[model samples]
Target: MEDIMRGRFSRSMITVAVAAAAVSAVLSVSITRTLGQAPAARPARVGGKPNFSGIWQANNEANWDLQAHAALPAAVTQPGIYPYDYARVPAAPVLALGAAGAVPGSLGVVQGDGQIPYKPEALLIKKQNAEHWIDRDPELKCYLPGIPRAMYMPYPFQITQGTDKIHIAYEFSNTARTIHLDKVAGPPDDTWMGHSVGRWDGDTLVVDVLICATHNLLKLFRFGWSPQRA
Candidate 1:
């Protein structure tokens, strides 16, 4: 009778081991099948066009000067003494900030020859504005940076696409603009952020912008004049 009981116990232990192995094998197959499935797809285009919905920002010094420029000690500079005349020093307004006020260099973002095609008179005005930028730059006063200028300002902007409009929200001065993809009347008055009309050119979205004359304090640099395209 003792031998019979021992044999029954051994069979019970074997049954338990087989049950555990079967569960583990079932779990392994389930895990394998799950890992083999394809991942969920992300939307690459909207309404049969490329999607432009996302946060964007410029990573260059185009906001300083759209044309190619070498790094400078300061945005505001004056001639140094004697042999160092070519080596300009920072002007009083930015002198105290030292390296912190220095201008960073860039290869420029101009589409063509990397130079703004400013007329002779406009060129002179551009120089004057650069000299007095501390007082003249609208950005210094938390003013709305107009198109293309708003595009490259040292701030991030968000793009949201709609069925008939594309909206851009800029971090600078909390400015924003909308691109009309459908027909609409122009703004009754000129605006600081300007009126933007947009259309699809193949996969590219082309925008036509019109800014107000009052916001032209840096007109030479604004109005899509610098870097050709931002």
Candidate 2:
């Protein structure tokens, strides 16, 4: 009887061990299959360069004023048509139109002392530009918005990149710019949109733009990490 009991106990222990091992093996195989089937990571490059293929935009009040500004009343206004309040006789067209045209307050993107370093004459010109912005602003006249302005115009822009060329198309005014990766001469004529030559500095896309006699340098890092895109 004792011998039979010992044999039965040993058999039970072996059965439990075998069952546990089988369960563990099944679990290990399941985990391996799940991990293997996971989506692959995004590629590092597209067409031998950093991929900048996406719709990009800037979300800030820089379009209104490059410098920090309080939410003050509009600079220009006409006599209010409403006769209810004499104190509010001079009201901006934006106010008359209601909240749709209200300007949101924002801090400046300019680094350092929060002031643009301009010569006296240049400062005077800037003031005049602001004072008569309705008429003097190039954007109001449908002029081509150049380099930095185009990049941050509170509108969407798309980048289509190839091995030897990159095309940037903007939503505002249907503005577009092409960047040649191959060696090429500057633009034949100085235009508002300018000419761009692009190269890769490590991971950043460095573009040197020449407009008229002025040279504007731009560096784009983290090509597709915008909140809207992400």
Candidate 3:
């Protein structure tokens, strides 16, 4: 019985020693692991200002047709590619060509029933404009697509922001907008891009735009920014 007790104690001591050795090895490995520098630093405010520096873009069909719409025929169509060979052609050439550039149906992003509010006369003008959009659209004329329109255009834009100024460079028409943070004054001129003044409300940037060329063009826009890095 004495020999048996001694054997049991020895075995317990051996098991405890093995467990201790395993724990020590694990801790040693954890300590020796190489933790390289993080790939990117978290976004931080400089001089107590929001950092809006980034490439941003809108993903929607707003650029094509602003209102909610069903699939529509393409703007332009040409004769069949196989002009002489009528037998090989499946159907009308316009139908085949139109299928490629047809605008996909969208529920639309516009607020309130996805329709713009216009007076009777203005609505009539808009309908006429829509009929002649190919020729009358401001975008086709290489005009600076104005606000709200510029924000959601189907192109990416880069924003470089500072405490005193914010610069937005758009991919379309190489257009851009400058938002002054300090100066308060009347618009120096009436232009497509317009004049902007900006202020911060928490992390949200509020910009007041004035386009003197058009009536009642004072628009206030807000852009909220978060510091979480992706």
The 0-to-1 C-alpha lDDT of every candidate, in the order given, reads 0.77, 0.64, 0.63
Taking every candidate in turn, the Cα RMSD to the unseen true structure, in Å, is: 12.1, 15.9, 16.4
TM-scores for candidates 1 onward, in order: 0.73, 0.61, 0.59
Q: Give lDDT tens digits, candidate 1, residues 1-230.
A: 99999999999999999999999999999999999999765467878898888889899888888888888888888887755744988999978778867888888889888877777766777887787777677786687767667888889999988869998988889898899999988779867766788889989889887645454534533222332222
Give the Cα-based TM-score of candidate 1 against the true structure: 0.73
Q: Pick out the ten consecutive residues of candidate 1 with the lowest summed lDDT.
A: 221-230
Question: How much is the lDDT of residue 77 in candidate 3?
Answer: 27
Q: What is the lDDT of residue 73 in candidate 2?
A: 44
lDDT minimum window of 10 residues, candidate 3: 221-230
Which residue runs of candidate 2 sit more than 4 Å off their true CA positions? 1-42, 75-102, 213-230
Steric clashes per prediction: 0, 0, 0
Q: lDDT-based ranking, best first?
A: 1, 2, 3
